[model samples]
Target chain A: MSGRVDIIGLGPGAEDLRCPRAAGALAQATDLVGYVPYLERVAEDSGQRIHGSDNREEIQRARLALDLAIQGRRVAVVSSGDGGVFGMAAAVFEAMEQGDPRWRALEVAVHPGVSAVLAAAARLGAPFGNDFCVLSLSDNLKPWGVILNRLEAAACAGFAMAFYNPISKARPWQLGEALARLRRHLPGSVPVIFARAVSRPEEHVEITTLADARPEQADMRTLVMVGNAETRLIPRPGGEPWVYTPRRVGMNA
Target chain B: MSGRVDIIGLGPGAEDLRCPRAAGALAQATDLVGYVPYLERVAEDSGQRIHGSDNREEIQRARLALDLAIQGRRVAVVSSGDGGVFGMAAAVFEAMEQGDPRWRALEVAVHPGVSAVLAAAARLGAPFGNDFCVLSLSDNLKPWGVILNRLEAAACAGFAMAFYNPISKARPWQLGEALARLRRHLPGSVPVIFARAVSRPEEHVEITTLADARPEQADMRTLVMVGNAETRLIPRPGGEPWVYTPRRVGMNA
Candidate 1:
């Protein structure tokens, strides 16, 4: 059998939200590899040999998948959101570039999926309506200074921003620092959304303003989105607020 | 019968790339409103009434969908990519906010689809594997100054960037100007991807570097991606090159 690797996204927490193309990759795979939580979401009846690893073991997991593919096994490397964004796709490529040159000859495909950014944005209306930037707040991969700089730049540019891995047990203050940096350049009334476990039963969405946005509102599972200067909110009589950023820039802007 | 509006994305192009949820929305839609090209892609035998409009008529198209929804018809406002990202979802919300107060009462749901950004990135091997910013180079909605400022900010901040609507017949020089701005902040060898009509039969993806990137490479249908400083490329013996931004940033970055 020809060896191949499919980097697939599970898409937030819902099965239906997963792209049909990604589902096809999983169906054809002989081995599955991802974080325990993501791998658990796949059906046991698929009969694919599964290898579940920790979230921090991305490179190792990628290596395992690459090795399996090199051995002529159909391997599917899974991620919770779009694999290309801070997910397995990068790790697999990194491994291929740094590890075995032979791995480059193996067939590889990255199947796009509905990302957490899209999933959260869909659940909370169209807050990401216009131009936006996405950043990961964890300093483990980069530095605190780099994250803060990007946050400030995005805020100053009046771009809607989505933050991933905003808060974790080891790095709790980064989210606060990010919000504070944005507050320096933006007004207090700018809208902020904290979407946790999106599309899942335990999903929670918190919509507030910059002045009211707290670090406690976000956790590792939370995807935080801060709207641009012109983001607007429409209050409903008996439901959650609807929020969106207008597509057009203001006259002065 | 109560009317509703489903703002759905058709994905980049392919039928299978379209989200199943979005397909369901189209199937349930009694009235469809979108640009002519997108509207033409929907199946004709679905029995849905189609309202095809001009490319620049987003607001008017949104208004028509809202009016149909208010008149107790299921309306689907279709966009080629995820509607939340520079698509019809914002226009629908903007129209609802400005046109009729009753529109606030109408049921509106935004169904997320695989965006062109994701689709293009997947085809090109995770060039967006790290944090990135997305901007529209078209200055029609926003001023040229704003687009230039964003281009500078994104390039300076070391974010991988995606440019939507990079070039049009009338505004041909913007892409070149945008590339020139990036050339200042990014190295000469930084990878740039020009992905056109992704997932379509005529789709083409050109992988080049900042030094060789040209304005004429892109058109209206193309999505351009510029990798961050740390992005890497893996060359195959007999295939197209693979590109990805490493998950970890440099010490200085």
Candidate 2:
């Protein structure tokens, strides 16, 4: 039988949120490759060869998956959220472009999943109801200045924003700095959502504004969303106020 | 029993791409409401009262769903992709905020799905591997000037972009104008993907350069993706070349 590599997303921490196609891919795999925590999310009795590695070793993992697939192994590379969005799909393609020439001939397919931003936005009312931009606040892959420039551009353009990798052990100051920069472009009353461990048992969502948001509230597991000027906060009877950006932008806006 | 409304996404166009949570919501719904095409995608013999309307009647549909839920009906309002992203979720919240006061008390939930951009990117080897922005080309709700301003800002910020509603019978010239504007900031060699009805039987993905992309190549169902300067194209043996944007950006970029 010919080998193939299927890159699949497990969704954001919930079994029900994952696509059935991704689940089917897992069942058909001879090898499973991903970060340790993501690998642990799979069923233990899948009977596939499990290769779990550190989070920082994406390139190495991609190469290993490709090498295994070339050897006629049905490999499945997994990521926590949609593999196409800041996940393993890009790394696998990057590896194919830079690694062994035969790797390009291997059959590779990426299956979509419920992305982190979409899951976080669903928990909150619909902060991404209108046009929006998604950025990673982690400056490890890109420069700090680039992130700031993109933040100012998206904010000034009046687009709501979703941020991944907002805070980590090594980069705690960036989220605060990003919020400070956003305050310069957006109103103090504009809502900011801090969604941590969304869709999991430990899920927590907090709503604040640009003027009062703190970086300490978020960790690597958190996804942050900031609304545009037209975003509204509707007070409900007994729960958190629903937040959403209107679909229509008035002429004056 | 108290009433509730569940706004769920049907995903791009495939049954397998829809989340199990969304499927669960649909199964539990007593009334299904959405645009005619989206509502038709559900099982016809599900025994639920189906309320289908024209595509332009979003606010009316949302209000109807709210009214039904207020009468103690289990309502499911469906959108094509993730309901939070330019879908029915925002319209539902808007109706609640502006309509009946009791609507605020009704339990409402938004379930995430495979969004159009994510599904399109997955089909084309992760074109949105890095920071990206999603914009709608239709100017029906927002002014054309605002859309242009956003296009310029996102392009200058070096973001990969996904455009929804690129071409409709009412708005044909806007996409051409938008592409011309993008050409001013992005190099002609930048890859542009026109993905029509992604994940469906009629799915067609065309990869072209900014200089070669035409507005006529898209339709109401197409999702357009424009890569940043760093996006690359890798040639394989007998099929379309793989396209992706690298996760890392050099300091010079």
Candidate 3:
């Protein structure tokens, strides 16, 4: 807690695509801090890896990492996409604020990464055409009423949407409920694009009608994109557009 | 072109963040293609850079890039963020289809990058919380009516929105029109975020009410986020929390 916390952004999944800064940070670190899955993503484990786990364990792991760093160990806490953006950096800052004085005094810096939202958006041409807001479906901390209000607002606004933590182990039906609500406001033919495991293994994208998408299509790693009416599934007849979205909105209508 | 055509991505703005594969693709390119500013942002220039002076020139540059690649030269057409999101990759494809059949059979691979929309979204939390849409307010190629219709539909649906290419040198008042339209359906206090020059030298972020944001606050490089009513800006004494609109339809909200 005595030393600074350097939260490194390894960018997206591929090592060939990893930032040199993040790689250097890890190589120089005496300890690493991050969720277990993220650690598993990085195979070249040289430093003392901080075994952080599930949602509640981040604070404890961050404290331990800060404590180790306070003992003069170079520490690097990892996040899959960007260090910021609903990632560990937010929790790290929270811990530093609520924890010991030594931790508070430490200098912290966040390196930006290629967030999956941006990655998924790029896969689809101009998915975010104008004004759009992103909200997580996980109710673990947020209330559903608040989530529904925002979803309604977003649907009403017709912004290209990117959904994260959409379908989870326990929260299987949240995304479905969201779709049903959106259907009430938006034309059912809106192109809803699902980019599964973007930038990693099992990377796949599906352009389907908002009503046609099944919950099984999405998993923890999947990044779902529900396109606006203008976005169309450009079916390539013989060879499908690597990306798909119906060209016309409300074709189902 | 005897060599393969690699459409590389320059992740955001920093050099260290450049995907190693993207960098490698650029290094092997005999000719590089992109808009002027994008080319300048890339770290190293190993090949002849084909900078497009105008939008129409994008096709010309793509043609040259394809021609160079077809002539047995390694060609890498560059895009500032991701090559696919309003970048050269699409133009390159378009050019290939239009080119003489003798030259159309060459291999082309598009490498992805961190797109600006996602970077902006990550900075603002999940702006795509529910259903949303993105639009470029620039009237260069698209008519104002087209943009207006999308905006109208989006407003009625209550989608969070992200506005790119909002203000330019000539069309200074376009954003004002958008703001005015949004105000009709949205509360004046709705969060309107401005992400200026993201990941660039003069990068800055601000969250203001829809009506409070002055036209002078934006530029060509700025990304404007007008959140749905559900999108609330948590104001810190001097700083604003990057807004995240939680969906309120289910228990999680």
Candidate 2 true-interface contact recovery: 0.93
Where does model 3 sit among the CAPRI classes? acceptable
Error of 3 at B69 (Å): 5.2
Best by DockQ: 2
lDDT at position A44, candidate 1:
77
Which is better, 1 or 2, measured by lDDT? 2
Candidate 1 on B32-104: residue-level lDDT in tens? 9999999889858568888899998889999999999989999999999899988899999889888887888
Better of 1 and 3 by TM-score: 1
Question: Candidate 1: deviation at residue A145, Å?
Answer: 0.6
TM-score of 2: 0.98
Model 3 over residues A1-253: C-alpha lDDT tens digits?
3455677667668777666766877777667777878877764765465555665476687787778777877778888876654566655655654567666545555555666766676555445433344557777666666667767766664555677788888898899888888888888888777887667777888777887977788888887777655554432334444332221233231
Clashing pairs in 1: none
Put down candidate 3 lDDT per residue, B2-65, tens digits, no spaces. 7667877787676765778788887777666677777766636644545445543767887888
Clashing pairs in 2: none
Rank by DockQ, descending?
2, 1, 3
User: What would the per-residue lDDT of candidate 2 be over residues B1-253, giving only the tens digit for each residue?
Assistant: 4779999988998889999999999999999999998988895766899999998799999999999999999999999989987789999999999999999999999999899999999999989999999998889899999999999999999999999999898897999999999999999999999999999999998999999999989999999999999999999999899999999987542
Error of 1 at A109 (Å): 0.4
- Winner on lDDT between 1 and 3 is 1
